[model samples]
Target: MPDPIYVPVLKARQAELAALSEIQPATRKAILPVLEIAPSEVDDPQVVSDAVDRISKKLEVWGGNELIVDAGFLSAGIRLPSGQGATMYATAKARSLGIGAIPVARLSDGDSARADVRNLQVEYDCGVAVRLSMEDMDEDPEELDSSITALLGDVSVRRDQADLILDLASVQGDIAVRGGSRIVLDVLRELEKVEQWRRVIVTSGAFPVDLSSVVPWVQSEFQRYDAALWDAIRGRRRLPRIPIYGDYSVAFPLLVSGPPFAPAPQLRYTLGDRWLFLKGRKNDPRGSEQFYEVCEQVAMHSEFAGAALGTADARIASPREHGPGNGSTWRKIGTVHHLDFVVGRITTLGEP
Candidate 1:
């Protein structure tokens, strides 16, 4: 494929990793993933070191050819125990595993982190990604130009060799959708004249922080407002380039959805414009075993895509046979199912 059909900005956790590792090869070829490496638990004293150690272990088995490694979730200026920065450590570990991972740099990053980017470009001659947040887009086009220049600083990687990412982060409500798209147009104005970008990707998530508003033991639907925001930009706004679509894949960017051991089982199945949510019986004594019942409901749905879709689908279709899996197992199941659904949409819907 000349260009990937989709970009999934996934958290580098066991659930997401397991999902990526299990997707069919054909589906895998269609995506360029942006793996957001998570930092260590806050309770840990050596978070910086722990972050490095964990990411190193994660990449050793990542098993992907191309990815955008974003350590934006890690502590900004903190140096690894090895005297390197987060991105530097991640890309190096990826290289050792023969993975063609591109390191990401942000305009708002600390001096040491930016310096790591320069070293990657100058010494390694490798590709780097420049990610700008929604606040960065708030700048006037001229001011945005200056920010990009300042971020590139000393060794100055060529813009044509770089991927420019405009991240909206999270969008909600109808008003937010409209406001977010406007910001996108503002940041993109006259940007092409500034430089020829290798690729432009816009990523955001709309999955709610929790399911408190949803009624337990009932099936409900929620809008994927992030996808709607991208549509608003693609159709309503006139821009120089069509950004590659990316999202958090059923998870929000900044918030945890709920406690891992919640009484009710949760099921999130993705469709194009909305998600089908099935919350288990809250007061049931079965607790997590309720997942089997919920999973069975999703599997039997008309849009389930059947067991042939992926590992998750198989487990979903035969929950008892697979065992009453925990939250992590269900996360992997839902995420893998989402991967199949999104890729299927891209291929069938044909450039939305």
Candidate 2:
């Protein structure tokens, strides 16, 4: 069948909004450390002003310390900031705060530890918490994505789980296979222990995927990604950032009378930093009130850099009166996560 007819007005509006240049909320100015006037300096207005000027310059010299990196165990007593939305807000803001600290606590090693970190961030509505230091994306693109992809493999599959001894690994167009006689053996092993696997039900924006190479059994997965990517790319100027190493799960919360659809919560998992962005629906006239509360809570807590709790603009299309689910209609909600908001080149692979 021929492709469906395309419209441009709404798509154009969406593209405009998506590409509309706006200052990121968490910027250098927001993170400048406030200088307290010392008694000596305060006695002289000029001294106080000089101190303030010095502090400002120092902060600038820090080059936007929005993300901080540190190692070694920190006290569990390090409590999150109080207030409802503080954690969420702080985490989102933390990124721009440049506070990308990586604590080297013994408890943060290996898969179990990593899983705990991911889960903690998700539960707390922390936007994009990462156990690892931010990786350099400017390096070779192929090498960077490949390293991340491998790291993700280790994170997802535990040693206690089925042993997947991939004798050969390759990214051919769209087909991914760990060849060798153990390939089938690994699948069987994993199936036997499937109960231990975490079942992630993805309910967020779609991403792009090449369809030609996906195995028939997993074609549905590819289709879902296709829909999401296609929806996002409409009237698109630049490519929408796709999931390179993360798992996203969404939950729909019931709403009172604002809209017919429920507000959905989205959880995004990434390698460098992990955070969960949640967007829920509210009935108040100025619906942003509750979200702001949550954002404030995240901000005060050191555990999260900050969070982005706001109305989500992405949507999944619904079925028409006599048509299949369009997969484009979006319900309003808030989202938070720690994955880098960057796009990469589309990859294609062919099956051998």
Candidate 3:
């Protein structure tokens, strides 16, 4: 597969997958998503297995397509994880399905993880994506090179075909955004000292994890610093290379644990480089009814992409179709719109 114009680092949640299902086929070609599988979502092997099964089936549609799949969340909480592990169960449990799932191997991953990544690289005949986080980048550039070179060797991937990813996840404040841009240039400076990579992706997320600070019933606007950070890097003069732009869409970079804390009906509408965050009171008796008004507001807004834009836009435009859905539904709506909007934005990038 050729290099993608956008790389959306997404959590493998139901809402995220649902949004992916709604994206137009032509739009899907613009993004190569890095799917993260969290093992802590469920404890029971059966349930986790079922979720992984569903994930595989959802991804099977993109068979013969390129996608980076990381079961690295397994590094934290072990359970039935990995698209590699999921699809391994595919042939024995169900009929065979083909998917060009490029495995990811981290510097801290164990021997088993390396083996799994290597097996996948060989099976698909594609190289792996090495995602270096702030923790990994904390080391000096020389040490950074050492760890990354060792990781690529462990996965047995040639540098020319490997994807070097700089994951600066969750740069929430202005200070962090500036720091993020600096990191991007620093990594680029280091890459100039190394061999060529098939693709160099910079991923980060600035979406606040919760809407706790916003006043209830107030529609607040927040900057998409993640986008701003990328723009700053692209606008910088004398850059080594223009790496691929990536972010977590509407989701935060750091994964939160426990049950979702969606206390009220909230709407996240992507308008240009900012999010129109609208929220209802917490613990309101009318569950999700606030979404109707929220949808109405979005539908009436000039930035609204109209009902025909995508499934989520259609839902936001038509409040009568079904009950105002819950938080997950809103996430799906927000993400679909974000994906649709950003795909076009990146196509005609004016940041530089």
Best by TM-score: 1
Report the poorest 10 consecutive residues by lDDT, candidate 2. Answer: 3-12
lDDT values, one for every candidate: 0.78, 0.24, 0.75
- lDDT by residue (128-211, candidate 2, tens digit) is 212221122223445533543454343443323211111121122212211211222232232233233222111122222222
Off by over 4 Å in 2: 1-246, 249-281, 306-336, 341-352
Residue 114 lDDT in model 3? 71
Model 1, span 245-289: residue lDDT tens? 888888887745433564368788887688888977768888888
Would you give me the overall lDDT of model 3? 0.75
The sequence of per-residue lDDT tens digits that candidate 3 reaches over residues 143-261 is 88887877788878888878888899987778888888887887788754444888888899878887788997777888888888888888777788888889898988887877657
TM-score of every model versus the real structure: 0.91, 0.20, 0.89
Ordering by TM-score: 1, 3, 2
Worst 10 residues of 1 by lDDT: 255-264
Best by lDDT: 1
Cα deviation of 158, candidate 3, in Å = 0.4
Which ranking of candidates, highest lDDT first?
Answer: 1, 3, 2
Error in Å for residue 288 of model 2:
3.0
**True-vs-predicted CA distance for residue 65, candidate 1, Å:** 1.4
Candidate 1 has an lDDT of 0.78
Superposed by TM-score, candidate 2 places the C-alpha of residue 347 at a distance from the truth, in angstroms, of: 20
